[model samples]
Target: MNQIVTFGEVIMRLSPERNKKFIQSNRLEFYFGGTEVNVGISIANFGGEVKHISCISDDFVGDTAISYLRKFGVDTSSTVRSKLPLGIYFLEVGAVMRPNSISYNRSHSSFSEIKPEMVDWNASLKNCKWFHWTGITPALCEGGYHTLKEGLVLAKKKGIEVSADPTYRSGLWKYGADPKETLSDLLNYSTIFIGGVNEMNEVLGSDYGDSNEDFIEAGKLLLKKFPSIKKIFDKIRTPINASWHKIRSRMWNGDEFRETTDFDITHIVDRIGTGDAYAAGLIYGLLNFDDFKAMEFGAAASALKHTYEGDVNFSSVNEVMNILEGNTSGRFNR
Candidate 1:
């Protein structure tokens, strides 16, 4: 069986209890989140052999993250335990005209202090068919960028297929180096490019059009520029309100662009890590199927993420298949 390994920071999300504001709330719900780590958990939940590689503090928050990943069947052997504490973020879910807000306090967390020598790249990626990562990892700090670059180089040297999601977070890139310089350097090693139009434009220095059609065109241009990129996956978002959203995705498979229609979700319990869920679904589809149906499958899985609360999507293969089969009635089970 093929195995996938993902590397990035794991944050402990502290969100206001219920629909209350952070200042008004006394209790906060805790959840484990990180772009690449969330993808690993989703892939593992879908029956994929997945491993998460990152450094976390030996603190309680780090332990919680480890326990959470283990519960989802993710291998933690590659995780390094440090004396530093885990990073954390505060989330305020929005309603009505207000939009969701997040405040981060992740300055010198264990993951940010990850040094290249701390990771045994050869051993971590051994027997792994696919190695995955995100641009956020490189934006953490100088050490973080070095760790990501080293991991990618090792994976390439071992002939392991690499997938990267240049998921740009402006706040996260507040370190010394600019994201454009770091991301451009990293893109040279990526086989799969995943991100939104704005993110691609910012990282690749390409003129991505504003509209979705133009975005697809820009993606095609990117594939032309980088011949090594076999596939380009993109997620489309249409916000109805603070509590409702329509999400979908498109893929340019170096030949033709395939798209899935917008999935209108009524109630959104949590919306933090939906993009990672979509990426995981896309990877699964690319590895398992050849047809364009993968786009729809990926879109359905992302839509299902809105119904649940937390960073990692808790969805099963059967539920995704049911949605793909056009069963959106959402009948309750006994």
Candidate 2:
């Protein structure tokens, strides 16, 4: 079977010790992560054959980053190495009422300097069954955007399914074009889209109502606008505090709405990469299960992610199924 391919930047994550604020902490833990990389890790954990494409500095940090991915079962044979330094981000894990904070030190990093000319679209995507990327990629540089677009076109030509998450971080798109236009341009090639209802209204001039009914209406309009889009998925979060939250996922498959069981998360280990976990689960489910099952599988995976601290969701498929099968009792295994 061909592998599922992902393209993006992988940064070195620096976080204070668990539950410690940055200003008060004297120690930091290092981990390599990025949106696409996180998703690739989850998919790989589930025994999916996955490959990631990106550039890192030709240094010890870059070598460690690639090895970190290899440890998680992701193929990094296509990774590029340049003279630039690796991107870095500082994360401060928060407690009740205090939110998590991220400070990026990633400007002009090796990954940001990568151009379309640096990658071979056909060779990278060859024999790939699915191609994945996010809004974060194009935000890096003009060459990044062109490279992503080229990859999308090449994937389509290769008959590969395309999945995308419109992460929609406004600050990332400061390279001179409106995020709306840029996102729409890339998303036009997507078969499965993961984004929010309000994002639709804010990004495009679409007036999908603000309420539940509005979301359904907006979903319909989105399908109409992008005929190739087969499934639209998003989740709703009911935060009880910084540590606990109620979450569930919903999807519009052009035919009907598919909803998942409501999930209550009483503890959150690290919320940073939970969205990517959800996306990975959804993508994995879509490849293996029906739409109804896929929705719940994704939500269950996210619920399990809340119990672990890291950029990757270490939860196994059995664990996710255990949660989804109504086995919420966190019992010990004999």
Q: List model 2 lDDT by residue over 1-334, tens digit each.
A: 3698999999989998988987888899988899999999999998899999998899999989999999988988888998999999999988889899888877688988888888887778776998888889988777789889989988877778999887877777767977778878887888988877866665567767546677778888888877778888887777999999887899887778767768998888888888888889989999999887888888888888888888889988998999988999888878
Per-residue alpha-carbon lDDT of candidate 1 for residues 22-114, written as tens digits (9 for 90 to 100) = 889888888888899889998888899999999998977778789989998899998998888898888999886788888888888888789
Error of 2 at 235 (Å): 1.9
Model 2 spans with C-alpha error above 4 angstroms: 207-210
Residue pairs in candidate 1 whose N, alpha carbon or C atoms collide under 3 angstroms: none
Per-prediction RMSD in angstroms?
1.5, 1.3
Lowest summed lDDT window (length 10), candidate 2: 202-211
lDDT of 1: 0.84
State which candidate has the highest TM-score.
2
**For each candidate, how many residue pairs have backbone atoms clashing (under 3 Å)?**
0, 0
Highest lDDT among the candidates is held by which one? Answer: 2
The alpha-carbon lDDT assigned to residue 236 of candidate 1 equals: 87
